[model samples]
Target: MPTVALHHESIRLHTPLPTAFGEIRERDLLIFELTGADGVTGRGEAAPLTPYDGVPLDVCAEALAVYASILQSYDDDAPGVLMLDACREAADIPVALAAVDLALWDRAGRRAGRPVASLLTDEPLDAVPVNATIGAVDRQSAASAAAAARDAGYSCIKLKVGVGDDAGRVAAVRAAAGPQMLLRLDANGAWDVEQAVRAIEVLSPAGLEFVEEPVHGLQALRAVRERVAARVSMDETAEDMGALIAGGADAVCLKISRCGGIAGLLAQAALVRSGGAEVYVASTFDGPLGIAAGVHVAAALRVQAACGLATLEALDIDVPEALRVRGGMIRVPTGPGLGV
Candidate 1:
């Protein structure tokens, strides 16, 4: 049997990470480690945004404690069996279960001396394109930031809207980014259906790649999608597989922390694809380890759209630089396990 260990830490960001929900200065991260009797170890991370993911930090900690207890009773010699049993036992706590499941996958990959990406798919990509996200700022600042991102070699840029003259902000950024750059707007479900329709109408001239979660609920989303020329992607509304399928979104955003682990992400990706929608891998502004996990999943899935993984620069600190983004693309780590 393997011994399971859980560790908690608070990581500070270089700047306040502001979104439509609120501003975040620090994040609570939970790291789970599973050690085999043979002494090899695997690591995973759980990052929950309270009131956002609807999972509190204390609840995640408690779930980890429960999972630790459940894993102690498992006598399975096969890592796959252990993973299955652990998932079944921790079914109620999906986020907590994700931490454990990710660690198990990492352990399995390490045991086989292959990277997790290779284990997940037959044709994994060597590099994946990533998008730079600009927080909501004043018109002048937004324009400057968008220009800087474009000059920095990022071909795709996602701007945080839904606050203080969103239409003005979008216009400024589009003007700065020019026509060739791929532009996206994430409102984080801040508008009513009427407001969304009006905003989309005003901003559509900017030529957006997609507008994410303009309003809450599937019905509102469908309404806005019908009225707007720009494509709509769902974030908060598509938190689970069922909501994602029901939302009828043009695209679905998958966050590993919110959607369980790699396995959970893959399942939802397949479901969204089956329903004729594109799947995008996104982040919760997690630490390096969690971001690395997302990168591997994006590579294995061969995600064609620009992913939201180029966010480590927003943090003041991160795990030793295990992954790097160049020319708006991230090179997947090829080492054993997560390659971190």
Candidate 2:
């Protein structure tokens, strides 16, 4: 096994990003690094926001400790799947498993002298289109943010609704962004079925691309979907994919940590696509490493819709060179591994 080390860090956000769940002012990350005998190192991050995912930070940290121990028992040349399976058996926590999986993939890509995306698929896109997020709740603030996003060359924008004044805020954003910009909403499962249907009906005049997690659970999602012409997407339901595969949503949002890293995310995306629903990657406000993993996976899959990876700006930390978003698109880091 390669040498393993773990570090904890808290990164402050540029501004408090408000959502239906709560406001996030800081992100806690478990940074994991693996160094091979040859002196090559690969990195991964485990970010657990308890308010969003219900996975406590210490829980994931403890699970990662177990995974590190499991890794030590393996040979330096152990198969990735074999090692990952062992870790999963020991601790079934997705967030911790995500960090281990990413580190392993990063090490493999570095060894093969290829980008992670290229290793995943025969053909991979050089870049993937990304959507800017507008977290402001008031009409003027939301409009100003939307206009700025449009002027910055963002073709798509995701607004946080189900907070308050949903109709007014959406209208202001629409007026500011114009009709051409793709508008999506994330309610964060704030509404019940009837409330979601009513909200979607009122907001659909803005020409929505989709509404994500308008209501919680598969049954509520199906009820809302039945009444709304606007497409409904699943985000929080990723853990309940058994019901998701039955086709209640028009799209499904897959996150790196939630899906247990890149490999598991791809496997889940396959299942989502098999059900005839579109699948796309979204960030859980992760750091550079996690965001880079999302880009690689989206590039390999050639996902058409704009992804939710343009989130680095929300953090106060410096943007890594390879993970920079250009003209509403994130270019796949051509360097070996995550290229950070």
Q: Which has the greatest lDDT?
A: 2
Off by over 4 Å in 2: none
Cα TM-score of candidate 2: 0.99
lDDT of 1 by residue, 109-138 (tens): 888899899999888999888998988578
Whole-model Cα lDDT per candidate?
A: 0.84, 0.91
Candidate 1: which stretches are off by over 4 Å? 81-91
What's the distance in Å from true for residue 202, model 1?
A: 0.6
Per-residue lDDT of candidate 2, residues 196-293 (tens digit): 98889888988999999999889888888989999999999767748559788999999999989999999999999999999889989999999999
Q: How accurate is candidate 2 locally (lDDT)?
A: 0.91
Q: What are the models' TM-scores?
A: 0.95, 0.99
lDDT of 2 at 117: 97
